[model samples]
Every structure is written in structure tokens, then in C-alpha cells.
Target chain A: MTSAVLKPGLTPSRVLIYAVLILACLMYLVPLVVMLLTSFKTPEDINSGNLLTLPHVFSTLGWVKAWATVRGYFWNSVAITVPAVLISTAVGALNGYVLSMWRFRGSQLFFGLLLFGCFLPFQAVLLPASFTLGKMGLANTTAGLVVVHVVYGLAFTTLFFRNFYVSVPEALVKAARLDGAGFFTIFGRVLLPMSVPTIMVCVIWQFTQIWNDFLFGVVFASGDAQPITVALNNLVNTTTGVKEYNVDMAAAMIAGLPTLLVYVLAGKYFLRGLTAGAVKG
Target chain B: MATLELRNVNKTYGSGLPDTLKDIQLKIAEGEFLILVGPSGCGKSTLMNCIAGLENISGGAILVDDADISQMSPKDRDIAMVFQSYALYPTMTVRQNIEFGLKIRKVPKAQIDQEVERVAKLLQIEHLLARKPGQLSGGQQQRVAMGRALARRPKIYLFDEPLSNLDAKLRVEMRTEMKLMHQRLKTTTVYVTHDQIEAMTLGDKVAVMKDGIIQQFGTPKEIYSEPANLFVASFIGSPPMNFIPVKPAGGRGRWHVPLATDLGQLSLPLAAGDADLDQRELILGLRPEQLALAAEGDSAVLQARVEVTEPTGPDTLIFVTINGTKVCCRLAPDLAPAVGEMLKLSFDAGKALLFDAKTGERLARESKTPAEGSAGNVAQFRGR
Candidate 1:
């Protein structure tokens, strides 16, 4: 039996706290459990039993069909997220380095403008972003989606990196400058090497965000070029074919798995990176 | 080894703001150690930064080797600096920290290794080469910071209070080490510090600054013995210079400053050139060591009751109320006075300085030998 966190004995408040926590956990876990169970069931079994019930017969048919349906779009999501995440993170680091360390006239105001981009709702940029992509001859392409994600992802990534870099002593840059290290050299050696935690935060954040992004994916790309989120939406919402709940559940699970795995593997660093700047002197 | 000259250097944050460094002028010969000493926010560090090319000067020029470097970037200036915080690269090991500068300047791989080894051995950190800054103690980190600056044979080195963070014992140890290092390297160096002892001990030339202006620039002895003004005199002494106000008097023709002692009033005569001091408040500046116990027959003795006694091992400090202000006198430990004992004090008359109380500027004139008749304080007290 797990003991209460604050007191070893089973106090009434401790019991009440654990009760509220367990209920919260179940509220989140229940949907995942339902998805997990339904994904393994045949459509007939899914209809016959409720969300929690075990399948009468476990079948690979749903898994096979979901993979067949979303396989191409998964690769597209990878293409969009991989380049988008890397480019956005690298640009953000440079932006952060300049903003925090090599400040020029109006740099703070520029950063203020850049930060304004972080608060901008994605819906606000849809029309202009589409127009720009169309002008660049990138409409309805994976390249267009990648560009959209990178442009959108930059605000948050820069915010993360800038906040982290601000806590780094300006003396470090001064010392580096006196050591004969120029701007890029200082960033590469003195700063970027010390930026691993923030990098982890940026990569994980951008990866999951871009992978799960359906708005830009749907707006910028079309048909076969749609990301896994768009593909999953299409697969789940179709009314023309008989509603296959099992396949729909499996497809949704498949689309969500990469982000889930990324979180599970690196969740500790993401949280650690966010608080590292705040607690540091 | 290079000579550094700051010619009419002026810096301001913006058009309307007061200058951070105002019309600063200084020159140090090759291999000289120059110290900029002052209190916090005195612009010593800012001047050092301007010298290092980290901060731009709004006017004037900095020359290294007699060439203008004010327009050059820090990298192009060939200057090295050790920050007060050490500023050691946190991610790099000791070796990498030392190697970084050489590698950035594109020195050969073999030369980089050789340079790192040289600095490591010189700083006595050969064993710490593999360890990161986080794993090192404060002193060790400081050594690595020095090692990084020393790795390159730069024209000039700037140290911005590099040892201020260490414990007292270590700070003293480092002060000696810094002087020794300068003697060996003989590079033109500029150092900034608030601690007067470090300024006195380390610099071949000391510049005492306050409020962004260089108040006095001279050798340690000159700065100590002939401080340009009240601030410099007060700032450069350990138990800072005692500044006692000279009591203003009613009879103006004689210009004798009055001091009320336990025995009687002592009148000090001012010269004809000091006639201007008659209308204003006057101050007398004397070092604690300048005050000594009066011999029985001494002429210019201050008679007062001792208020406190502090025996600082090397010397004893006896505090007495003189002219209503607490005054400190340094005497031999064996002659330590008991608290509340009445004591007779006499100061070196020639070295005594007078200042205008309001402006805090030294009132310079030929030495005044305080009238010998004032010594009657001891005789008067004894007779009573």
C-alpha cells in the first residue's frame, strides 16, 4: 500500500487527496484505455461490447487496415516534422543568442515583437500563410507544410531558448569576446554547448507539436501529402463507407504513437528544461 | 607587452544621460600594472570594459602600442580579460577552456595543445585539465579563468576585480600571486578593484576614481600620503582617514581654528593664503597612524577621554572624542589605553591636511605648523 505523501498514516485529508488524484488519473486514462481496447477489437466486437470490455476475439485486421491507410501520411508527417523541428530549433537558438547576449539597438523591441508571435493564435495566420506559400509555388506540397510548421514553431522555440539564455551570465560572452572569439564562435563554443537542456525542450516540443498539427497540415497540403493527423481525421470521419470504429481507433492510435513515445522517453527533460531557467540565479 | 593610453575618453549611455566615464585620461608604459580603485558604481569596471573594447566610448580613443583601438572590436584589439565571476566556460573542461581562444584564432592543433599545457602548468592546474568548471572550487575556477587569459600572449590583460569573490585568506594569497605574476609576465595590464589594499599592493600606478572621474592618479605612496581630495584620502586607507571638522570661530582676523579639548580649547592658526577658509567650515584630515601619544612636554596635544579600545594584533586602535567627532589613534599594542582613560594625542603637523568641509576638496597650502602654545592642554590639565 502506498502511504500518504505528507503523512505516513492514513489521515482523512490524505485519503481525500489520493481520492481526487486517482479520479483525475482515471479521467485521462479511461479514454486511452478505451482506445487501446477498441483498437484491438473487430468492429462487430466493438459494437457488441462497451469501451472497457475485452475483445471476444483479438484480431490484426484493424491494425493491418489502419497501417495500410495511414502509412504514406506517416512518412509525410516525418518529413514535415524532422526538417521543420531541426530548422526551427537552430534558428531559435541563433535568435536567442543574439537577443540575450549580442544585443543591438532595438534588439529588445525586436524580441518583444517576436514574442508577440508566440501569443498569436494559429487561426489568425491561416489566410496570409496560405497566400505566402502559394506565392512561393509550395502550395499542396509537403515542403509547404514543413515551411508552415517551421514558421509557426519558431515563436515558441525562440521563447524557450531566449529565456534559458538570459539566465546565462553576460560575462561569459564578454570573456569569450576577449578570448578572440567572434559572434558565431562564441555561440558555438561558449553558449551552444551549454544549451543542451533547452535544445531538448525545443526538439521535443516542436516534434510533438508539428507531428500532431492538423491545421497547417490541412491548410498547406492536400490529398496524399496530408500529415498523419489529417489522414487520421479523414479516416475517422468518413460517412461514405460503413463506420469502422475499430479501424478508426487503430488509425488514431497509430497517428498519436510517435508523439506519445517522444513524451514518455523525454518528458523528464522537457519539464526540467522549462524550470531550469526559473530556478537558476 | 604594450603601452595603453586613454586620451580624453568619455562614455554616456545616451545623449541626455550623464557620462559614465567623463574625460578620462590615462597612460601606462609597457609592463606596468595600473589599478583603478573606487567604491561600487564608480565606473572603474566600465572604464576597464571600455579599455577591453567591450563597451564603446562615446568620445576619445584608446591606444594599444600607440595605435588607436577604440574603433576595433574586442577580438581585433588583442586584449584578454579575467572577469570578477571567473566566467569560466561551464560546459568545457579546464583544457578546453584554455584551448578555446587559440582554436578560435585558428592556431595549429599542435600549438593549441602546447599552449594549454603551458598555461595549465603555469597556473598549477595541470591535474584539473580534464575536469569541468562545475566540479572545481572557486579558487580552482579562478585559476582556470586566469589560465584562459594567459593562454594567449595578448598585448594587454585586464583584470576586473578577479579575486573579490574569494575568502579573505585566499584573497590575500591571490593578491601576492597577482603581483608575482605581473612581475613575471611584464605585460601591460589594467586592474580594477574596490579594495584599497589590493590597489596599493598590486599596481605600479594607481588611479583612484569616484563618480566616473579619476580623482587622483599616482604611485601608491603618493595616493596614500597626498590624496588629491577628501574622497581619495578617505577611500585609500584601511581604517579610513579620520576627518574631524575644524570648529568655526567668531574672531576672523587671526583665522585660528578652534578645537575644544577636555582640558581647554586649542587654537590653530591659518596662514594668510588660507583667509578664504575663515568664512566657511573647515575639516582636518589625518590618518590614524599620524596620531601618536603625546610625550609629557609635547606642544600640540589633544586631551580627551578614550571611548573604546580595539587591539588589531599588529597595532592598537584607541578611539577618543575630539571636537565632538569620534577620532581614532593608532598606537603600539603595548601602549594600548584602557577604555574611559583620559589620553593626550599629538599628530604629525606637517602631514596634516585641511579641506573645505562643504566641497570635499583638499585646501592646498604650505604646511601649517599648529601653534605650539596649544600644547598647554596637558600642562593646564596637570596644573588643575
Candidate 2:
């Protein structure tokens, strides 16, 4: 019995951790369960029935209507998010490689400015940036939303790549240089191959940020190009008609699926990168 | 094979920072192994970086085969370096790690495979070829790191304490393997280490460095037998050479040094005409192996009380007080002496060295061996 507690298979510490994890999972599942139950109910049933009770009849009507209500905006969100994450991560990796390896005057200052931008409040520049987008004829378009997300995500993506690149031994770079690899060769062959873990974090982080972004879409996207976040707000706020709680909850779940799938797929790298950064120094 | 030269190389971290490597001028012959030995912060690694083109020299030219390579990028410089941390690409299998350089250079696929096989076999790491660096032991990782360098046919190789992370027994094994590998390849290599034994046994020429300056550069035998100053003497040996202080006594033609110990004052004969005799105060340099228990009459025997004895399987180190300084004597294991016993010791006077007590420079002299039984009953005192 004592040995059982000492063994990792069913140790007391392991049992306690498992219990807490189960509780946390239930806590997270509560809101999702409520949303799912409400989505299956008729508008009156959603307002009048016990939330925990099983429905006498289940229907796909809520999903059908939710798909129709904001389908264009959901497609727009995907269109903007995909390109924005790719652009931000690509540019950030290049900047990170140069900053980490090369020693030039003002390199420190450049990095300092980039780091400073990461902590700046998004609201502080929103008005002026929106005005600039208007002047540049990028306002009220999917491109405009993409630009905003890319700008906001650049600092974080660059930091991830920069820290990862710095951990690569300088000797490897030198060896590559002696082997006739120039700047691009070293990046392509050495740094890039060694950076899978960091890249996974970058993609997952920037994808989630761009997908869930409400402010950028609300300010920049218009009409047919509005993202799911903006459309979901519209669906909730249209006061002239009866509010459809079932469709609203279903639409919200549909809008959240992309980020959740990405998180699950890349969670290993995301957590590993974070823990490695803490200990590698 | 190529000759390399660093002509007045200078490296400073920043504009106002003190120079890490200052006006370092060196020439390494083709197919020679040059070992850089120094304490930490002595810029040995920095020098290796400059040679590998990893660190840019602030001033001066680096020439390979008499052509200036100072401005050449590391890739074009044709040098390979094995780092202190091994720096194995953690994600790559050992086979890929060895193939990386060849792949970068666009070597033929079939030939790359053959070269990898060769190095893996040579380093006896063929079995680890499929494993990642993390899965292998430290000693195995070190061999893979060396295999990576061996896969490249660069003009020179730089090793920065490559075996420092291994266990003591493995380090000794690798040290012998490295010597044998160097002998076979005849490659021009620069190895940096603080281990004096490695420096002594590995290099064709060893440079003793201190605070960014090369104190002396010569064969290990020369550096050992004729050290440039007190620092080299103190730094180069295990159990280090003992430095005993003394004052010149008696008149001309018969110079003697008065050693004051807890046992009593005894006069040790100095080689006549030793230049440092004029200085009055001098330091006597003796290797621990040179001192022995005096069993026969000897002219220059000094009596001291043994304080401690350490017995290893091969030899025993007996510690005694001489001229108020603790001196260690390496004696055969069977010739153990008791603690607190008065022991008369004899040393070959011909091998005795005298130094300036102030400047610590060696005093020039022709030393004569002590005549057995000529200096009378001094060796008869095993009395205590």
C-alpha cells in the first residue's frame, strides 16, 4: 500500500492532480454545455426550461439558421486570419534571425522598440490607425482587418523566434558560414530546421489571436467582409426583432471551433516552448 | 593542409571595453597541433572564435596559406569547430548531425553516406547513429560532435574543451583517441583547454597564456623544464612545483641558503656563481618528484619534520616543512615515512632552480650534483 503511493502509476500526488484536472474540465465544460443545450431548444424552451434537463426532442434547426445568419462573416474571418498569421510569422522570423545573429549598430535599439510595442494597449493607437487605414483606402475590407491583426501580432511572433534563434549555438552559424552558407543559407538550412517547436507556437498563437479578434474586425471590416466576431455582435444587438438565443449560442460555438482545434493540435509545442524558454537561460 | 597565421590580431568587445585579445601574433605550421592553455577569462575561446571567423577581429590580418582571410566569412574560411557544449542539433539523428556539413556543401548523396559511415565507425559511434543527441550519453554525444567535424575536410579544426563535460575516465580515453586521430589525419588543429595534462600530452607546441598574453610557447618539455616565470611554474603541474623562500648566507665561492623550519635552521648549498645570490633573498623551485628520503651521505641534504603523507597506489606524497613553506615530496609507495618524524631529504642539486624573490625570474647558473659522502654526517640523521 505504501509502495502504491510511492509509485507514479497511482500515487497520492497523481490522484490529487487527476481530481483537480477533472474538476477544472467540468468547470470549463459548464458554459459549453449550457450553450449546446440552449442551441437545441426552441426560443420559449430556452427561456423557460430547466437548463440541466434533457430535451424531449432534439433538432438541427438552430445550427441551420446560425449557419445562414453569419456564414459570410465566418468565411471572411477564415480568409483574413489565414493570410495574416502567415505574413506575421514569416516577417517576424526573418527579423528574429537577423536580430539574433548579426551585430550592427542600433540593433539593440530596434529590439527595444519592438519589445516596447508588445506591451502597448491596443486602444491607444486604434483611432489613429483606423484613420490611416481610411486614408490608405484599406478601411471596411478583409485586407484592412488582416493588416491590423498582422501589426498587432508582429511583436509577439518576433520575440518567440528571436529567443529560439538565440539558443542555437553561434558555432553552428560559423560552421555554416565556413561551409559557404550565406545569410539566407544559414537561415534556411540551419535555423529553420531547428525551429519547428518555436514555429508551431508562433502559428498557433497568431492564428488564435487573429481568429478571436473583435476590435480589429469591428473597426475595419464592413458589410460582406465583417468577421464572425463582428457579425455575432450584430446578431445579439439587433433590437427591432425577437432575439434568437439558440442561433446566437450555436453561432458562437461555430466561431470558436477553429481556435480550439488549433490549440489541441499544437498544444504540445506551445507548452514545451514556454517551459524551454524559462529553463534554457 | 594549410598554414595559418594571425598577424597582430586584436579583439575588443566594444569601443571602450578592455581588449579580450591584444595584439596577438601567432603562426601555426601545416599539420601541427597547437594547444592554447590558460585560466578562465584568458580569451582562449575568443582567439578560437577569431580563427574560425565566428568573432571578427578588431584589427589585423588572418592569413591561411599566406592569403589574407580576415574579411572572409566563416563559411568561406574552410574551418570547422567543435564547441564546448557539443552543440549537437538536438532534433537531428546522429547521422543527420554528421551529414549536415556535407549536405550544406552539396556533396553527392552516395559519398555523404559513405563519409558518415566512415566517421561513425572511426569514433565507434555507429550504433548511436540513429539516436538523437539527448538519448545518448555525454561521452557518446562528444564523439558525435567530433564526427561532425571529421566529416568535413576543412583546412583546420578548432576544439574548445570538447571533452571537458565527460567523466574523468572517459576524458582520458578520449584524450588518447584524439592523439591517435591527429596522428593519422595529420590535420592542422588548434585545441583550447585549461587541463595542463591535456596540454602537455596533446600538443606539438603549447602556448601558456595569462590575461590575454602568451607567457611562453614551446614544446611541453621546454615549458616544463624551463618555465618563463613563476606563473608558468605554478600553473603547469599537478600538486604544483614547490616554491621555498631562502636568504643567501656565507661568503663568496661557497654560497649557501639558510632555511628556517620548525625542526631547526639548516644551510642548503647553492651552485657557486648563481646570479641570484646577489639578490640575498631567493625562491628555490623544486618538483615534488625530485625530493627523496636521504639514505646515503649527501652534500646538500636538509633535515625536515614530516607533517603528512598521502598514499596513492603507485606513489606516496609526503608533506614536510622547509624554510617555513609546506613542500610535498613524491616518494615510492614502499618508502613511507611516519608523521612528525625528523626526515633528512636529498635532492639532485643539478636540477635545483633559483629564482629572484622579487621579479620571480630564473637566475642563470651551471649546477653541479652533490658529491656522495663529501659533505659529512648530514644524511646520518633519521634520528627522530
lDDT against the true structure, per candidate, is 0.85, 0.83
Tens-place lDDT digits, model 2, residues A79-117:
999999999999999989998898579998898899887
Clashing pairs in 2: A177-B74, A177-B75, A178-B74, A178-B75
Candidate 2 structure quality by residue, lDDT tens digits, B1-384: 799887888889888888888777777799999899999998998888888888889998889999999898787888888888887777679998899889888899999999999998899999989999889999898899899988988899899999899989999999999999999999999999999999999998788777776766667776676666677778898789999987877766577777766766667777757443654677888899888888786766677888998887788889998866899999888887788878888876666778777787666555422122223211110000
> How do the residues B263-347 of candidate 1 rate in per-residue lDDT, one tens digit apiece?
6656655542534554677888889999999898878776788889999999999888778888888999998789888877876
Top lDDT hit: 1
DockQ for every model comes to 0.85, 0.55
Per-candidate alpha-carbon RMSD to the true structure? 6.3, 6.6
C-alpha displacement of A101 in model 2, angstroms?
3.4
TM-score of each: 0.92, 0.90
- Per residue, candidate 1 scores C-alpha lDDT tens digits across A105-190 of 99999988988888899999999998998899999998888888888888898899899999999999999888888889889888
Predicted structure with the largest DockQ when compared to the true one: 1
* Model 2, position A204: C-alpha lDDT score: 96
Clash pairs detected, candidate 1: B299-B375
